[model samples]
Target: MTTTQNQDTLERLREDYPGWRIWRSRRGTRPAGWVATSLTPQDGRAPTLHADTAEELELQLKNPPMGIGLDIPGQLEWSGGR
Candidate 1:
């Protein structure tokens, strides 16, 4: 996808999942992947997902039963912050 489209998707995910923290690399750092994390419902332990690309994140968003209420733009906003 185009850079603009990818950025929009990331922003949506951040708005959708407010509780989850998103991380991205700074200048000169390796573009490892995107990380979404939250406290476990059962024990309050941290649970996280690593997505290497926008496509993977989009797939996760499409599947709602996965328990993450993520939208594309939110994720983009979060990533852009970093």
Candidate 2:
């Protein structure tokens, strides 16, 4: 997992979703990857979404699932049609 990219993505999520707690976990040294999660009142024991990489996590933050109940402040500018 790229620490720089993971932290950057985490900060972006925090900025987009106030009051929602976000965190990241490294997928150990073997099959290297990172998992980012967001927890809210609507999400009981599980995260609202999980992403395998920093890039994917950023994408999820930009386009979250409907009815998650978290209020995002504004729209994110997408690039490359992703």
Candidate 3:
């Protein structure tokens, strides 16, 4: 995701979750995506799951140990013609 998208997700998570801490891990230059981990404020145990795309991020938000978080651009496009 792009930087813009990441920021948007961060804001949304903050508003929705409040207490859930959000951390991002960006790996690789191409096909870049973020790993938003939700941890317990006290123990900080294992993360719920890894969300890379917008769809997955949304799902995690709806049902997860954490909230909503995503990378930039938060969208996929395709082109086909002749």
lDDT of each: 0.56, 0.58, 0.55
CA shift of 74, model 2, Å: 32
Off by over 4 Å in 3: 28-31, 41-46, 65-82
Q: Report residue 29 deviation for candidate 3 (angstroms).
A: 6.2
User: How many clashing residue pairs appear in each of the predictions shown?
Assistant: 18, 0, 3
Give residue 1's error in model 3 in angstroms.
4.7
Write candidate 3's Cα lDDT for 1-82 as tens digits. Answer: 5778767876776577654555465556554443445555233333555567655765665566532343225373445652
The best candidate in terms of lDDT? 2
Error of 1 at 61 (Å): 5.1
> How many Å off is the CA of 39 in candidate 1?
4.3
True-vs-predicted CA distance for residue 59, candidate 2, Å: 2.9
For model 3 the TM-score comes to 0.46
Write one digit per residue (lDDT tens) for candidate 1, span 1-82: 5557656766877777675565543346445566666544332233566677756754554442343444445355555656
- Put down candidate 2 lDDT per residue, 13-55, tens digits, no spaces: 6787664566665456443443445455454323555667656
